[model samples]
Target: MAGDGVRGQETAVLAGGPADGMRITVADRPAVLQVTRPCVVEVPFGDVRVDGLYVYRRDLRVDEEPLRYGFDPASP
Candidate 1:
């Protein structure tokens, strides 16, 4: 994997670090990265293969509003 998080022929894997507080996995239907904790994730300019993926570009906002999604599952 490239240290710069850029694409080549190799791929980069994102997962929980040694601190044991993160769990990286893919979501279903409306595809989004579901991370267990608040951590900084960097992806290379490579292939992001999701089986049934539906994603928007970084510029797309929700309801034409600012990006205001949180990871807190308890919240409404």
Candidate 2:
């Protein structure tokens, strides 16, 4: 699959390395898709198809505001 960025924020990570087995299987009889990873199974909404799959990881962090009112009065 071509490496494309979705929502201009998350990028798709093509299936490779040890995580290649990760896949989503759709059952035509029930109209559902199942995401499988090793020993875990997750059923997500929408039509289950290989063409709609894009995988990526996201990391978020929070930092303190320098102008906040808190202070350590006793510190030398």
TM-score, each model? 0.17, 0.14
Name model 1 segments beyond 4 Å from true: 1-32, 36-62, 74-76
lDDT by residue for model 2 (1-76), tens: 2464222222222134233434332121121122234432276547553332323221122122111111122322
Backbone clashes for every candidate come to 1, 0
For model 1, residues 1-76, the per-residue Cα lDDT tens digits are 4585443322112322222233222222132333333333375436553232222221224422232222333322
- Name the 10 consecutive residues with the lowest summed lDDT in model 1: 51-60
RMSD of every candidate to native, in Å, equals 16.6, 19.4
